[model samples]
Target chain A: MAGVRILVGTAKGGFILRGDERREHFTVEGPLFGGWEVFHLAASPVDPERLYASQAGGWFGQIVQRSDDGGRSWNPVDNAFVYDGEVGDHLFYDGTPQPWTFQKVWHLAPSLTDADVVYAGVEDAALFRSDDAGASWGELTGLRQHPSGTQWQPGAGGLCLHTIVQDPTDPGRLTVAISAAGVFVTEDGGASFDPANRGLQSGEIPSEQAEVGHCVHKLAQHPSRPQTLFMQKHWDVMRSDDGGGQWTEISGDLPTDFGFAIDVHAHEPETVYVVPILSDSEHYPPDGALRVYRSRTGGGEWEPLTRGLPQEHCYVNVLRDAMAVDTMDECGVYVGTTGGTVFASRDGGDNWEAVVDHLPRILSVEVQTLP
Target chain B: MIRVTLPAHLRTLARTGREVVVEAAGDPPTIRTVLDALEGAYPVLRGTIRDHTTRQRRAFVRFYACGEDLSQLPPDTPLPDEVVTGREPFAVVGAMAGG
Candidate 1:
């Protein structure tokens, strides 16, 4: 009775899709918190039943929702995300110094080992950890207080710490990516951090290889090969061999390298997937065709998997956190688009089918494999 | 008990009806005291109407009593006699915004 649960965060609410191991059929569950923008939804690897969601909107602000029964039921947890000490300032859009402010949580990373522990990546660029499930939170200020923090600028999406990758082998080591600020790595847990964007060149910035000004869109890492990382930058697809210490372009033959979502195959460490959009200005697929490019030999070699996808008149964009892979034997890959379609590829990326269509614009997609 | 009318969204969040009654601490219940009591009764509504740290009313949130806009008034300003006597319910409204 093994199953897979796909937790989808959308602009309006959250939905959970349940499918058996075959991955052919799925039952859709909710609009959990209607009228609220659900930024991200994640379940603890340690306890599949425990889940956390980042529910936020302009009118109601931010509220963390927790589900102990695996999205069957949920309750509101602590929403207070106060900074640790004096909130410093970062460069505003106009290059003027602006004070850091708490906006909303962008991503949630549950502990790899502890069900009660979770980390929240939030806008205004800061990290917060909650040890008592989602009942409380405390900022891990070292990332924001880095020496190069003053030079950090907001991307089009605002200054947000959107992606967080935790090393399964080393709990103390964590890597986080910020928009318009590049990447940061922490070795001593959250006590300290260092910029890890060496070889990441952004032509948009004054210095192409600057230490911490690149706008990284998303990052993906395989559990077995933690040292090797795949990234979808604002304009390029990249790979890092030494745990993000150095990176090299792998955008190779992509029609366009500007995309938001990137993910690695569940069983193949070298296999990665990315949806190439036209460009930064035109946030849609090339030639009105939606294709998910898969690279079996890591970055350089890739092929389009478009069996069941839209080949014409498609103009939807895939967000940074809208792609995920489930740990099934066949390796199921899922992608949610801004046009409200959730596509699933049961046999790697060769074939695809829409699990559910016409949902609100999807914000994030996460999968859980149940035993 | 001071009667307060909440916006649709806030009422749904607090799991209450359109109107709720709370006991404000001071003899003359001001906006601050009434909100403190409301938050104390329903902790989930803490940061919805105002900020968690600064306690400032959210930009789009407004307050009114006896058809007078009280959003610009100081937090400590006394409520009108109708509101204080429970004859009129102090209103917490979400201003018209977004398409």
Candidate 2:
């Protein structure tokens, strides 16, 4: 078996895309997390056998599930990351006696060097770290217990860390993006984190409501230059060179400022992809054009990649996890939309082809080379 | 008496065009009662809107009316009297997709 595989997380469950170097095919072996919407799907950086999925709310509430054997079977990690007093000495900062809302797990990252050290960013502005490969987790005391956490108003999705970017070179270095909460980074594991939204814009609130944190939609990191980061903000696509210390708007020439997902090439950090949508009115694209923008010089300039896409009125929203870039030679760039359509670009967004459609609202898209 | 609108797909499945009329016994109608009335009139919609066990709305369906996310509103909650009076229509939007 080739070490290439693709996992598409949708409102229904997750579908594994299996195929060879010459031709790839998709099989819907899912509804993996019961009837919940799986928004985040991640593969174990240390072990290919392990897979993790964070399901968005539906019938089963928000939940996370683990699979030890590809996508064939799955079991919920009962103690995935409970914050109640019953689980060890861990506790929330507010000390509120009420239980957590069981918020959605928006993003998951298997540790870069430590096999068992997994990180999860969840709704309600919570951050958790697991030293046991997600079997159990502890809240990041600094971010979770920050004085500001309680007052942080929840975005439409809630005050959540939707993206987690870890420095592959330095295990201690990490960055997290929270919707409406801006961006935060840690240099020493997670003992502490500082607001990194120096030049980033955090939309306008009444002066009384304004503070740190920006309304960050999505973010991507350069594999070679960790300090260089790309982000899709609430109303703009911007980039930070000094590690979020400052930002520059790169979305000047796009169709619209509103978009959910952003991806960087595995080999070419400068190359990135984004699915543009109309700002959050009805949360669909303007004029229903199904197009994605590609940037080759780290958002220096972007061009619309619209080969093989629907030209008529198409009002589909693509979630952040729904678009990704694989490491194949031609580099497979895939994006799933709320219309239940999954499109793939084999020539690195230069050309496109429809892989599947009419399945379910897609939540996340992950690609791996199967062995 | 609250008014609930169904997307074109479910309406097609129910053999209706678009938007089916449903009746509720309470003041402020809820997702459950409206869905119950819809299912009662069209048995074909029984297991489609929500599961029999959980009664939770399917992932693809969104419940909106009077600026509220009826999805989380308790199934038994009173849907606003306006909706019950047929003066206002609660929209059940179908999430769109592409790209």
Candidate 3:
């Protein structure tokens, strides 16, 4: 029990990898929901044994599976993500408003305090809550009904609410980021929300400072300093200091800022991690060199960490939700590549090694720190 | 009694024999009645074959009986006599891929 277990969700199934605190040796468990598309996998904060996954079938729609005993066994829970009241429409790719429809669950963020309560971010852009231990889901329609809803358009990945970050200091405070839509923050729980995309720019859009419609790929925040945030935009790396009130570009010195996946170090608040893709259209590393860039000065300056990683002839891309950090003293960093490899670093980001390689394409990766 | 054949995934989910017999409950045996009985008997299959709220067949699912595509027919439409009489299992199938 004094080690680390990683929860990995992939295109083919869900897998659990276990290792010692050093993270050198490991055991790979499963392809749990084989043949299903597992979009996101996460473990409940209070109870590491409790886990939840966002899975969907080609024909059966989305299903939420829960495991009370870590990843040993799984049971399909209430995956009925019915929107509150009559769901309206959001702007489509063509700019023609289309009816809002439930597509799939994109992300699941379990509550830090209550194992029974978890937040789900979904596609077609909405947030849902399941307080009954993933037995049922009810949409928090207030976020979707924001005045900026009409202006939100789909990114290449569709308009999906992919990032869910809860403030550690205030239990009621929550923040979510949607692709092509931007960021929204709720101070009084999910009853209401406000667009938090001030000082952001999108090259595709005509506005230099639009309130919404920014394609935020991934976002991560340190628990001790929740107000300060880091983001990997569709084209740039940005940081927000005032709880997303405003953001400034911090893509300095990286080969390219366009990438997915951003995470804060477990122990170092100023340290952050991101994998730089060549560009949105290319979806590969710069010059086929897979590097994990770390920003120790909180984003203005950066350095690349690549020891055991593929520095040559690697063209895999890390998805937005594929990177995670473990709360160990040395602080471990992990990222899942689209090519089906999970790379891990135990001594911060100085060096990395693959825990498990050659499975299905990875969609997300999460870690559990055990006592 | 009615005989029903489920798609592979649904069969695995329902945890039943490939061909199952349902009582059709207290109603005349129709496609809807048999489906309702199947769902009631296997709770795990709820919303798998049809929309949970609308009860419409999933876009990729189809119904066939007596070698005819009964998918376009309304849910309330009476299934063919062979299916209701258990002479043939009402085939619930995954629509052939790519039309």
lDDT (Cα, tens digit) per residue for candidate 3, span B1-99: 888888776776666778887888544577788889988887777777887777888898888899999889877888777877788888889877744
Candidate with best DockQ: 1
Query: Would candidate 3 be rated incorrect, acceptable, medium or high by CAPRI criteria?
Result: medium
Off by over 4 Å in 1: none
lDDT of 1 at A91: 99
DockQ of each: 0.78, 0.05, 0.58
- Write the residue-wise lDDT of candidate 2 on A1-371 in tens digits: 66356788887777777656743555556556544577778888677768888765432244556877877777655333445333222123333333334456778888777666788888666788888766677778676655555545555776678888988788888898887777888888888887777666545544422445467888898679898999987778889888877778888678887888998987888887888888776688777788888888777578988888776788888888888877777777888888888888778888887787786888788777554
Model 1, span A1-371: residue lDDT tens: 48899999999999999998788779999998988999999999999999999999898799999999999989999999998888889999999999998899999999998889999999999999999998999999899999899999999999999999999999989999999899999998888999999999999989987999999999999999989999999999999989999999999998899999999999999999999999999999999999999999899888999999999999999999999999988899999999999999989999999999999999999999899
Ranking of candidates on lDDT, top first: 1, 3, 2
The TM-score-based order of candidates, best leading, equals 1, 3, 2
User: Model 3: DockQ against the native?
Assistant: 0.58
Candidate 1 lDDT (Cα, 0 to 1) = 0.94
Give me the TM-scores of chain B across the candidates. 0.97, 0.82, 0.90
Cα displacement (angstroms), candidate 1, residue A222, comes to: 0.3
- Count of backbone clashes, every candidate in sequence: 0, 19, 0
Higher-lDDT candidate among 2 and 3?
3
Q: Runs in model 2 with CA error above 4 Å?
A: A56-62, A84-100, A206-211, B1-99
- Pick the winner on DockQ between candidates 2 and 3: 3
Predicted structure 3, TM vs. truth: 0.97
Answer with 1 or 3, whichever has the higher lDDT: 1
